[model samples]
Target chain A: EPEVTQTPSHQVTQMGQEVILRCVPISNHLYFYWYRQILGQKVEFLVSFYNNEISEKSEIFDDQFSVERPDGSNFTLKIRSTKLEDSAMYFCASSEGLAGTYEQYFGPGTRLTVT
Target chain B: ELKVEQNPLFLSMQEGKNYTIYCNYSTTSDRLYWYRQDPGKSLESLFVLLSNGAVKQEGRLMASLDTKARLSTLHITAAVHDLSATYFCAVVNAGNMLTFGGGTRLMVKP
Candidate 1:
C-alpha cells in the first residue's frame, strides 16, 4: 500500500527563523491536508490543499503560515517566523475522492521543536 | 459549528474485558471515521462509517454509525495490551474537513 511520506522526522529551529515542512502525499490522492497536535492536546486542522490552492484553513492558520504544492508530488508548509507555540507534531494527510466518504491516509508526522 | 464528543475520555480495563466507546456529534453528517494513534505517532485509520446503521469490524474492534442519531460507537471485544491507544472519531461535514472528538485513551492492563 502507498503511504504519505514527510521529510525531516525531527526539526529544531530558532524562534524567529523560517522553516518549511515537506510532504509527499500518495501519488493518486487528490486532496491534501495539514494538521498539528500539541503535546497532550487534540489534533487541530491547519489547512487543506487541492488543485494547487487552499480549499480551507483554520483560524490558527494565520498570516505567518502558508502551504503550496510547488510540484506534482511535493506539498510544503512554510512558517515565516516561528513562535514557541508553533512547536508541535505536524501531520500530512491525503485522500482519493471528496471528503465525508473517502478515508484520508496520514504520514508519520514531522516533530517541529521551536526553541 | 460542529462539535464531536467522546465519553469516558480515559479508560483502563483488564485484559480480556469488553468495553464500548461512544462518540456523539452536534450536526447532521452522513460520514464518520474512527482513528487510532499511539503516543507520538500519526493517526491510523480504523473504520469509516458512511450512513445510518453502518457497521464495520476488524479483529476485536467493531464500529457502528447512526447518522439519524448523530452518534457512533466503537466496541472492543476481548481487549488486549496491543489495543491500548488513543482513539478518535471525526465527523465530516459539507466542507470535507473533519471535526474530531476529544479522543478516548484506552489502557489495557494484563
Candidate 2:
C-alpha cells in the first residue's frame, strides 16, 4: 500500500538555527497535516494544508513555523529558529478526503533534536 | 477547546488474557480513529469509527465508538506479546483537526 514518507529521519540542529522537515504524501492524497509529539507526550496537531494553503493551525504553530507544498508531492515544515523545547518527533500525514470523513495515514516521522 | 483522554495509561496483561482501553472526548464528534505505535515507530491506523455505535475489528483487536457518550473503546482479546504497543484514539473537530488522547501503552507478557 502507498504510504506517506518523510526525509531526514533524524535531524540535529543547534538552537536558534533553522531546519526543514520534508514529506512526500501518499500519491493522490489531497489533504496534508503536521503533528508533533514531545517525548512521552500525546501527539499535538501543528497545522493542516489543502490546496497549497494552510487550512488550520494550532496555537503552537506560531510565526516561527511555516508549511509549504513547493511541489506536487513535496510538503515541508520549516522552523525559522529552533528552541530546546522544539525537539520532538514530527509526523506528516495525508488523507484522501476531509479528516472528518477519511482516515489519515501517518509517515514514519522525523525526530528533531535541537541542542 | 477539544480534549481527548484515555484511561489506564499503562496496561500489563498475560498472553491469552483480555483487556479494554477506554477513550473519552470532551466535545461532540462523529469521527473517531484508533492507531497503534510501537517504540520509536510510526503510528499505524487500526480503526475508523464514523458514526454512533460504529464498530470495527481486525485480528485480535476490536474497537467501538459511541458518539452520544463521546466515548470509544479498543478491546483486545486473547492478547499476545506481539500486541505490545501504545494505542491512541483521536477525534476530529469542526476544523478537520484531530485531537489525540494520551496513548495507552500495553505490554503483553507470556
Candidate 3:
C-alpha cells in the first residue's frame, strides 16, 4: 500500500531557533494536514492545506507556523522561534477526497525535541 | 467547537474476553473514524463510519455509528493479546475537522 512518509524522523533544536519538519504525502492525494501531540497528550490539529493554500488552522497554528507544498509530494511545516512547549511529535497526513468523508492516511511522524 | 470523548480511559481484559469502547461527540457529526496506536507508533486506521447505523467489522473488531446520538462504539468480540493498544475514536464535525477522543488504552493479558 502507498503510505505517507516523513523525513528527519527525529530532530533536536534549541529554543528561539527555527525548525522544519518535512512530509511526503501519498501521491494522488489532494488534501494535506498537519497534527501534533505533546508527550502523553491527545493529538491536536494544526492546519490543513489544499490548492497551495490553507483551508483551516487551529490557534496553535499561529504566525510562527507555516506550511508549504513546495513540490508535488513534499509538504513541510516550519516553526519559527520554537519554545520548550513546542516539543512534540508532528504528524503529516493526506486524504484522497473531500473533507466530509475523507479518510486521512498519516505518516509515522517526526519527533521534535526543543531544549 | 468539536469534542470527542471516550469512556473508561483504561481497559484490561483476559485473552478471549470481550469489551467495548464508547465515543461520544459534542455537536453534530456523521463521519467518524476508529484508529489504533501502539506505544510510540503512528495511528493504524481501523474503520470509518460515515452514516447513522453504519457498521463495519474487521478481524475481531466491530465499529458502529449513531449520528442521531452523536455516538460510536468499537466492540471487541474476542480480545486477544495482539489487540492490545490505544484505540481512539475521532469525529469530523460539519466543518469537516477531525477531533479525537481522549483515547482508550486496552491491555489483553494472556
Candidate 4:
C-alpha cells in the first residue's frame, strides 16, 4: 500500500540553527498534517495544511514553525532558532479526504535532536 | 479544547489472554481512529470508527466507537506476543484536527 514517507530520518542541529523536515505524502492525498512526540510524552498535533494553506494549528505551533507544500508531493516543516526542548520525533501524515471521511497515513517520522 | 484520554497506560498479559483498552474524549466527535506503534517506529493505522455503534475487527484486534458517550474501545482477543505494541486512539474534531489520547502500551508475554 502507498504510505507517507519522510526524509532525513534523523536530524541534529545546534540550539540556534534552523532545521527543515521534509515529507512526501501519498500522491493522491489532499490534507496533510504534522505532529510531534516528545520522548516519553503523548503525540501532540502541530499543524494541518490543505489547499496550500494552514487549516489549524496548536499552541505548540508558534512563529518559529512553518509548513510548506512546495511541490505536489513534498511537504515540509521548518523550525527557526530551535531550542533544546524542540528535541522530539516529528511525524507527517496525509489523508485522501477530510479527517472524518478518510483515515490518515503516517510516515516513519524524523527524529529531531537539538543540542 | 479537545482532550483525549486512555486508561491503563501500561498493560502486561500472557499470550492467548484477552483485554481491552478504553479511550474517552472530552467533546463530541463522530470520527475515532486506532493506531499501533512499535518501539521507535511510526504509527500504523488499525481501525477507523466513524459513527455510533461502529465496530471493526481485524485479526486478533477489535475496535468500537460510541458517539453519544464519546468513547472508543480496542479489545484484544486471544492475543499473541506479536500483538504487543503501543496503541493510540485519536478523535477528529472540527477543523479536521485529530486530538490524540495517551497511548496504551501492551506487552504480551509468551
Instruction: Estimate, for each residue in A18-111, the C-alpha lDDT of model 2 and write its tens digit.
Output: 9999999999999999999999999999999999899999999999999999988899999999999999999999999984567889999999
Reference contacts recovered by each candidate, as fractions? 0.53, 0.84, 0.50, 0.82
What TM-score against the true fold does each predicted structure earn? Answer: 0.97, 0.98, 0.97, 0.97
| C-alpha lDDT (0 to 100) for residue A24 of candidate 2 | 99
Cα displacement (Å) at residue A22, model 1 = 0.2
**Where is model 4 more than 4 Å wrong at Cα?**
none
If the candidates were sorted by their DockQ against the true structure, best first, what order would they fall in?
4, 2, 1, 3
Clashes of 1: 0
Tens-place lDDT digits, model 1, residues A23-112 = 999999999999999988788888888888899999999999999998899999999999999999999999997845678889999999
- Residue-level lDDT tens digits of model 1 in B14-88: 999999999999999978999999998999999999989899999999999988888999999999999999999
DockQ, candidate 3, comes to 0.62
Interface RMSD of candidate 3? Answer: 1.7
Interface RMSD of each: 1.6, 1.6, 1.7, 1.4
Candidate 3 segments whose C-alpha is farther than 4 A from its true place: A99-101
- Candidates, DockQ: 0.65, 0.75, 0.62, 0.76
Q: Clashing residue pairs, candidate 1?
A: none
For B1-110, candidate 3 gives per-residue lDDT tens digits of 88889987999999999898999998887689999999888999999998899999999999999889988999998799999999999887644567999899999999
Report the CA-based lDDT of candidate 4 relative to the real structure.
Answer: 0.93
Q: Judged by DockQ, which candidate is best?
A: 4
